[model samples]
Target: MPYIWLLPAMNKNIVLASTSTLYEGTYLDYLLPTIRELYQGVTEIIFIPYARPGGISHDDYTARATDFFATAGITVRGLHTFDNPATAIRNAAGFFTGGGNTFLLVKQLHTLQLMTALKQAVESGKPYLGTSAGSNIGGVNMQTTNDMPIVYPPSFDTMGLIPFNINPHYQDPIPGTKHMGETRETRIHEFHSQNAIPVVGLREGSWIRVKGNRITLEGALTARIFEQGKTPYELKTGAIIPF
Candidate 1:
């Protein structure tokens, strides 16, 4: 089944990326076209909005997402009406995950055992798209998420659709603002100390498109790869990393 899964894995199936959702603007110039291509058509997208880290209810999130899609004139709905989640993912032309707190998303995914069900959908050649926290779940694990893992995941095992970790909102070290316990550089350095996992720093407007092993960088500049014991290196346009 491993090799059997590899074929579809290498074929066109999933779209995992950070959120291009600017508050007042649409993601068309940044996000929608790639989704349209992945689904093989313009699809009526579904939003799963569970923010607030382990204590979120899906209502307000859903309402906000509905409004976002409605503005673009695409029929969008929340993945809540159906009690049977397998049925929910199975019936859809494509699945999109909106970003919030990745730790929260993973906690819910584990608690519900939706990981198995969602993985089944991806393996069957269905398109799966994740944004921000959504994209974080595509990696080997969510260890790199800026959010604290207040709730444990089903597994550190992410969707494994991608080999690297994603650090969305990849801002350079802030000079004077200190809100979280550690400085930006200190936090990332701590992450490096704990794991050797390669992390990809994605700026707000940037993303990567995985179309059958052709992992291409989009939006602007290049992706920064950070690892333990080694100096961070920059991978520019047309670089195909094994991870």
Candidate 2:
């Protein structure tokens, strides 16, 4: 059976990947095909490297994405390449936000006043792609992120492109393990204590495909969803999320 429902009227396209890399090959190797399909008409992409995964420099991060997208015959230019970040996003053919520290990314976005521009572009029917912290910002706020507060932004609020929150790199409690850290589930429960917005725990291999009002869960794994006052439930692959 087909797992994806083609919605031509969606008017917007977004890819929210839990991680940029999976198990090994290369950055976005696991999702290159999907990326290609989602970004069909896009020729050049505006890369937002503020997240700076591994504390890498923005130029370095942009270089990595440039190399990856080159495989798809698409050109990638960093937002920093332009004199104005907001203008860069507003005029891009497509948008891609790489993963790193969600706080840092949010800070840069708000600092440059590009956050609203990004939301406007996406809502205006531009194709958008995000991974890790990038995907976390697609939600109502970054409060559901698992990353520590390395920096403070003007607000925890994000693009709110999607109605709910996204908990990327979600992991379950390993049985027979001696680790005493709070499991991802526990932390999400704590988030629920204060927020009513539902959170989808996207495992490393899982992704959410957003086309306007419809969202479909993809990949080989099941996503864990946490709702207020309700037990976190597993949403299997091919499930259509009620976002």
Candidate 3:
């Protein structure tokens, strides 16, 4: 039988995207429509750039997101610029967390004691968007992330906004290749060997949409699902994730 985990009653409005940029596309080019809908009626939002992709400064990362959201008539301010990030999160109309190194991002959030605050804010129905490493934090923990351990966090525990974890940027093995490296599925299976949490392998161009208590897969492609013991399966687009 397939595994099922019940989730708590929630008031979440979140978009956990697999990646920020798609092949041959500009930053956030593909998700602009979704962004408009997710943050509807909200003119301003806070951008969490703690991931700091490629070691870019917070200001630079924020600028990248700012430029992208501007097209949708929304303004973005970096969380690092505020006196108290936790306070800012509570006050912000919406939030967007850009992609980068998951380890570094988790460390900063934990070190600054803002994880719980952010979680509370989002749980209160504030619109929240996460891409790549940012989306990893939306899971039960960051253990399924595809990032190097460049920094250690106080704990692997994430916000647990969803009942299960997610493996962002999930890819399938090529039909015939001699590379012999461990596939993404292999790593996830190993995780199941020790952990019971279900994992959704979110492929590029796909995202998980959360509205209140309903969680659904969004995009044109199918998503791979993995449970502890059952054989992995594919979830079609627009289908509610069974957790």
Candidate 4:
């Protein structure tokens, strides 16, 4: 008789993309190749579409994922399809939360009372993926998001899956420009005035890959790290996040 052995213990696999669309192509073009390995054995993905980019319907958002994942031989199911979102999260083999308005996304999670369940799933080593607004809520709070308060959520708190906050689509100051607008850095600095948590400024084309206790920078672009009372510094690709 042959014995079936259990899989070896592995770290929690998490992908937090800065944005969904790249300048060159469709959604998740850059990460598609690498996604297969990160999501090994995951034939189904639970798609969370509460963010509703440009007010897109949940079905449309789910279809976007379905179209993309179909090529990978995976099936995508929207959380909205299930009668109980909490139960869906609890039983999900893997998860993918799309990009959109952070306020809208957070509000829906709280209203549905699935925030805790989602966090529990991620913490329990479920393969989790997030982009833009989805990545924003994976942090300590939604205070760092660039979007305005189109709608107010019951709380600014988030899943806290990661210890720090994330500011996606982070832009640097333009050279010799006269706009005189507050730069992304300045806004983050203002946020630091009240909050002591670290904030990562993830520019487009960059991302954070979390494997249990380690988070390394990925992509061609460098990410800016904003620590309380310290000057922000750039982290090169492959650099382990130093919190």
Candidate 5:
């Protein structure tokens, strides 16, 4: 009856979210090592490099992912083939979703009917990690994502392993160029105009992680939680979110 299937803290499973562009992902060095410490360590890391959409060809995508994991000393495999997404996911000692376009990633997974499978695999007592777009899908819905809906993804069904919707790259104020982007606060407000779901604004270099009922905030500064009537509130480490 649970919308999400998360193994308790006893399993030692966790998720690391990155909402920044992968090309600018310098924080991996900081996060990956901590992921290794969770439950001591993991055997292998399976990379799900499927968020690029049509920006790049599948072969190129796969090749790029294969090479990235090579440096980590963790055996890596690309699971972009739609025919058997769940198979590859289930076999992973742990999962990492690289940053890209969350909308594209969600659409592809839904279209291929792999969203549920990805969700299942991550919650199956193994470490499931996501960066940028990869991290966005961990939440209940994809509205927090910044990617445009260029392609017709299969469904809105993302991994949904995490309860609160995640707005990766979340920032209170937009700094420089304005190409007309939606703020995390604005988007969540929009999402709430219809749905009453709680949302977490996770800035770059930060993550919201849950182990059993205890959710912890990591990385820089703090995270913000937003709901309909209430004003967005700031949270530091060790804070328990109502979501």
Candidate 6:
């Protein structure tokens, strides 16, 4: 059985991935098949590069996505290139948000007032793909992100395409090491102390795939799951997350 959203009317087409590339892999090469299926019948997509990983320019970031998608026979356009971004989103065939700094991405989206527009477009059933920081925005809020607060957004709020938050590039605790830092689990525990939203610790090579009312975990690895008050657990590949 497929996982169902707690909220109703979640009929959108979306692929919220843990990362765009795997170790020793090319950009988006690991997800080409998934991308092809998600954007079926669509020839072009608007690439949202607001996250700007490593301070890369929008044009350069978009060029990377363009090059990758071109292999799949799809055209790519940067959302920044449009005169009116909101209008561009509304008219877009689909959207692909690449990974980067969540803080910067959210700041730009809210500042430009494009958050709601992008949300509306995706909710309308346009194919949407997100990776890393890009996938973080699909959650209830950006508070669970692992990124540093390099910039401040008007709100920690995000698209909430999924009913829960996503912790992309989630890493497990190293069994033995002198390095001491808060585990991803500890930080998420801190988040749960104040917020009741569930969070999915999406591992690399895995993703949440949503089609119409069904949402399923894809790829080889198991995903860690966290709820506000319950013990953390793992859901294996193809498991329907019961939020």
Candidate 2 lDDT over residue span 154-180, tens digit each: 988899888899999998899999989
- Pairs in steric clash, model 4: none
Report the error of model 3 at residue 117, Å: 0.3
Report the backbone clash tally of model 6: 0
What lDDT is reached at residue 97 by model 3?
90
Candidate with better lDDT, 1 vs 3: 3
Off by over 4 Å in 5: 1-12, 20-27, 38-41, 62-68, 81-83, 174-182
Every candidate's CA RMSD: 3.2, 4.5, 4.1, 4.4, 3.7, 3.4
Q: Which runs in model 4 stand beyond 4 Å of their true positions?
A: 1-10
Clashing pairs in 3: 5-243
Q: If scored against the real structure, what TM-score would every candidate get?
A: 0.82, 0.94, 0.96, 0.94, 0.83, 0.96
Indicate the TM-score of model 3: 0.96
Clashes of 3: 1
Candidate lDDT (C-alpha), each: 0.69, 0.89, 0.93, 0.89, 0.69, 0.92
Question: What would the per-residue lDDT of candidate 6 be over residues 26-88, giving only the tens digit for each residue?
Answer: 899999899989999999999999999999999999999999999999999999999999999
Q: What is the lDDT of residue 134 in candidate 4?
A: 92
Worst 10 residues of 5 by lDDT: 3-12
Better of 5 and 6 by lDDT: 6
What local lDDT does model 4 show for residue 231? 90
Better of 1 and 4 by lDDT: 4
Clashing pairs in 6: none
Model 4 poorest ten-residue lDDT run: 1-10
Off by over 4 Å in 3: 1-10
